[model samples]
Target: MRQPALITFAVLCLPFLLHSVAARAQPEPQSTGSDSDIAITDFSKPSSPGRTFAARTVINAPVQKLCGILLDYPEYPAFMPNTDNASVIQAADDFAIVNMTLKLPLGKIKKYRLRLEPRNTPQTCHLSWKQVPWEDLKADDTIADTSGYWHLVPHPANPARTVVDYFVYADPGYVPFGFRWIVDILSKESLPKTLESLRARAAELP
Candidate 1:
């Protein structure tokens, strides 16, 4: 009778012990997206003279496929509603100079030439850009100067999912005080739409 009672007590404690162990062993859930695992370093600050905004998303596509779409300048105008036109003037060694016109909400268009650099790694592709100063409007009438980077990082567990990290900086110029509001709205809204468009276009790819 004593042995049976001891055995029953042991069995009851086993589950509780195992559960505690399991709870301790479980890891925390991480951010999932295009650059999910990659560590991001932010150089922008509110105190800095330039204003910066950043956004990210997890794209349900491979990194290679995403990179291809990003570099597809000519087709951008057709699939990306915000883009009025895009043309690549030069390309060499994973870098290209592209001229693009973005449609603003006020029925105006803003054009800029961006120098794109692509970094190809085993599991990721990073793209960064700087505005060509010459392409920027004359300082007297300019509203803002913009620059940013995009990262396509592959998910470790799922090869089909890629995380996209995007950062944009805007330096609102002197003349148009109202332009600041437009820039702020565009910074928040435009990038997510662009990512959605990229996903749609990738799914349609043959």
Candidate 2:
């Protein structure tokens, strides 16, 4: 079942729905440690009416290594919070189709498939994606489709260290998004936890 744009837009455009807030508030650093400094921001600002938001950090790993970690879908549940399991059902050098099951903050478990496309260049690599149809999921109808990106840009002076950005835009169809409490709780769990875990993983790798 296709989700209506109104609901998706409403959830995305929450802060700007009435345009009451003029400037988007930057999120404080979620955690700080010797491995890396991780920061998350609400890119879905009042300046722009969209669902996209980003998590950023600087790691002691090279861009290539970082990309490899991101593509290792099967390991997500180990580090990323709320993610129950993830597997790459199909993949090639340039693209991959992954199946994921996640437990939302409110204890709602949903499954979906994503088609990931990677773009590579000499110094930078980025992956962008959208939902895909997958028969094994048995979840397309109940859960809303979602999309986002992962960006890796290496430090010019320190090539071995890289700056990473993770963006996620989701719409939980028919879910009670209007409940600010649920939104607040899930917000604290999802992206922030993912970045924290990712930073730890990158630092631990040799």
lDDT of each: 0.71, 0.70
In model 2, residue pairs whose N, Cα or C atoms come closer than 3 Å (at least 3 residues apart or on different chains), thus clashing, are none
Show model 2 residue runs off by greater than 4 Å: 1-36, 45-50, 135-142, 177-189
TM-score of each: 0.70, 0.69
Ten-residue stretch with the least lDDT total in model 1: 34-43
Q: Which lDDT value does model 2 have at 204?
A: 84
Q: Residue 159 in candidate 1 has what lDDT?
A: 81
Against the true structure, candidate 1 reaches a TM-score of 0.70
Clash totals in order = 5, 0
lDDT of 1 at 152: 78
Index of the highest-TM-score prediction: 1
**Residues 25-130 of candidate 2: C-alpha lDDT, one tens digit per residue:** 4333344453256666664555532345567777778899888888787988877777788889899988888888877654567778889999978788788888
Looking at model 2, which ten-residue stretch has the lowest summed lDDT? Answer: 22-31
Query: Highest lDDT: which candidate?
Result: 1
